[model samples]
Target: MISANKLAGASSSDKYRQIHDAFEKTGRHWLYNATVGAGLPVNHTVRDLIDSGDTILALSGIFSGTLSWLFLQFDGTVPFTDLVDQAWQQGLTEPDPRVDLSGKDVMRKLVILAREAGYDIEPDQGARGVAGAGALRRRVRRSLL
Candidate 1:
């Protein structure tokens, strides 16, 4: 598990609980390779680089590709609903698509990033000013279905 944020008020346990709750509620298992980037240990990297600052400039990244596997299963003409069903069966999404579809995953990542970037970002604060991510949302939705 990685350090989810670096705010003054949010405890380490609180962030871990939030990640745990997200996984529990969505029934999706996550295994992140904290070594892929960030030269230091996961928690320390976040604290030294991202949390020691303010004004998060940008956020971007890729997500899981379970839907890609699901799509490749089809010979042709796969029904959207069937794909949706399969994605669910694979634990690829939450009970609702809204969370994954609405960029909440990235939002969570961004909250973590913003905190890394040294801002005191909470989930609600990240959620407060979201630009419409229409294209990205559509792609995630299509993948889910």
Candidate 2:
């Protein structure tokens, strides 16, 4: 019969457990980007960028499509409505996409990123949503056109 500790050790080898361990060890976070076809590696992590004093751009959007889809939208090949529909179909958006569109999700992400960068930002302190009725879409369309 396997001992409890042995079983625990065996189970800890699971991929998610390993990832959790890495995160604990390094105090870093990882995000999987389907457009890149892989998780951001350790060297390219947010912590590394912040530590190195490099500028980091984080885009927080409700569209569940891959990062490549986002780029296409930027180029005006994809419509904002279509992106929202796709994200809903993919179960990535709340039943009310407004919650995301209102920039709450983006604010949360920004707060986390700021905290990791050594900023003591309260969740309610620094988040301002730029979301408005068709504003983002109109801006993108205008810029690309």
Candidate 3:
């Protein structure tokens, strides 16, 4: 019943109107959260940027702190274990953080963005997670003092 990227428009207002109309047609009460608290306008914004010939860099991540924390970890400031713990404490991760770490969620978002940008990309065509649960666990253990 809830559609994330079903209808898109040139502008945010147009997208809102389209979504509103769709809900009205369906006679269902719905809530739309395009870029409210998420801090990123994933689809509609990407479409606009692509249309205007501007380069758009999308960093898709879980709702929690995994993606940003991973970047920090890559910088050698934060340990992988700290990032994982922070993600759990901040509730930015899924019920199973592995779902976020698996990179499938990011891949799906990329697939949607690619399709919106006129590319025929299958979900599986996106990159997979280089680190699995066992690898992450090992890295976290190694980081422990």
Candidate 4:
């Protein structure tokens, strides 16, 4: 079975308890692909690493379409607030831009990546901080959404 719920291992065990038990009892395999990078094969790569007995200490990347465009459109000349507004107007930001600025979605993806690397941890359980995400988040909160 293949599943791509983008749950990011968030309450995943409980969420998939029945499915997991079914697979365990039936000796069937379950392919749960946590998609955080659109259709990128990051989870697959991590799974392969684990299957090959390799250790992964870290994983990082831009995992949000909204943020990706925002980052690319940003320059030192323009205020982040203006850029955020532009992003919103251009439909490059989330419905609530603050959601993207907060990095929760990205954090969820990170949690999934870590899970793929064999870490049983929650989003809050792990340390999370994006260098400039806070500034952007503040700008988004105060100026836009």
What's the lDDT for candidate 4? Answer: 0.73
**Model 2 stretches astray by more than 4 angstroms:** 1-44, 49-83, 94-96, 131-145
* lDDT values, one for every candidate: 0.52, 0.49, 0.57, 0.73
Instruction: Name the Cα RMSD for model 3.
Output: 7.9
Q: Please give the distance, in angstroms, between residue 90's alpha carbon in candidate 2 and its true position after superposition.
A: 2.3
> Ten consecutive residues with minimal summed lDDT in candidate 4?
7-16
Name the top lDDT candidate.
4
Ranking by TM-score: 4, 3, 1, 2
Among all windows of ten consecutive residues in candidate 3, which has the lowest summed lDDT?
Answer: 2-11
lDDT of 4 by residue, 1-145 (tens): 7665545255554554566578899999766663566667777888899999999987766678888887787765688789899989988666778978887767767777787788876667655676687887799778654
Q: Cα RMSDs of all predictions?
A: 10.0, 11.1, 7.9, 5.0
Each candidate structure's TM-score, on Cα atoms with residue i matched to residue i, is 0.42, 0.40, 0.50, 0.64
Q: Show how many residue pairs clash in every candidate, following the order shown.
A: 6, 0, 1, 0
| Model 3 Cα lDDT, one tens digit per residue, 37-133 | 2545656666677788976555444543466566655655766667877777887755667756776545545555565565645555655556486
lDDT (Cα, 0-100) at 89 in candidate 1 = 81
Where in model 1 is the C-alpha error above 4 Å?
Answer: 1-44, 51-57, 63-76, 124-145
Candidate 1 achieves a global lDDT of: 0.52
Superposition TM-score, candidate 4 onto the true structure? 0.64
Ranking by lDDT: 4, 3, 1, 2
Error of 4 at 91 (Å): 6.1
